[model samples]
Target: MKSELRDLYQEVVIDHSKNPRNFRKPEGANRSAEGINPLCGDEITVHLKLAGDVIQDIGFQGAGCAISKASASMMTAALKNKTKAEAESLFERVHSMLTEGPKSSVNPEELGKLAALSGVWEFPVRVKCASLAWHTLRSALAGSGAPVSTE
Candidate 1:
């Protein structure tokens, strides 16, 4: 059963990486962020169209390993239609799960298919790969002048 779960996770990761949804910027995007993993040269640019507190549309463009690309793809899908506050909360939840450790507080199902990335914690070197886009999103939302750095 564990092996089956692992296989399923791998498939999810691959599918998203290969055919990412919302992979192009929307016209006249009001907000944007660029994220890069210097180690592997993974680069992502996230574009957002906001309607007040709600995220009306979201998209991205990037090249990266399966993990980084897939995470960004899933993130764009998950955050669309979400309020700014909700997006922040979701980001915090996923960030804690990846950087800290999984805990009962995290709803496993709420991660949707992104739970596939749980394996990333075991591969310490790839943690940044998984988090690059997330940090970028946070910086974009916060309007921070500092570069997004998860490490």
Candidate 2:
């Protein structure tokens, strides 16, 4: 069982790093922001199309470690069609899980493939890698280019 979980994580990481969904600039994107991690030179641009409080579409473009790319891929997938409030809640859950080093407020099973990234907390340096896109998403939602400090 442990080996199976490890394999699942590896496969998810590979798939997202190789072929991340929503990885292109959106046409007429209403919200967008770019984020960078000086620690590892990871960069990402997050774009969003929102209808009222709901995210109609979400996309991202970035170059980073396997964790970063995979997290962004998982984020885009998890947030699609969700209300802005819902997305924010999800973001908080992920952030707390990664940064707080605790059991996530998010149900791991409900997070779908994103559950693969739960192990990232064990690697401190990689936490920023996993959050690059998330910070970008927050900036986009805030309508600012200000650097987001996740720490």
Per-model TM against the reference: 0.87, 0.86
Q: Predict model 1's lDDT versus the native.
A: 0.79
At residue 86, give the lDDT of candidate 2: 82
Off by over 4 Å in 1: 1-9, 145-147
Model 2 scores a TM of 0.86
For model 1, state the Cα shift of residue 13 in Å.
0.8
lDDT of each: 0.79, 0.79
Worst 10 residues of 2 by lDDT: 1-10
Model 2 lDDT per residue over 1-151, tens place: 5864464357788788888989887676788888888766778888899778878889988688778888998899899889877887778878877776555566666667777777777777778888788878888888876865445
Residues 1-151 of candidate 1: C-alpha lDDT, one tens digit per residue: 5864463347778898899989999886788877777777778887888888888898989788888888888888889899999999988888776665555377656788777777676567777987888888877777553555544
Local error of candidate 1 at residue 37 (angstroms): 1.4
In angstroms, give how far residue 115 of model 1 lies from its true place. 1.6
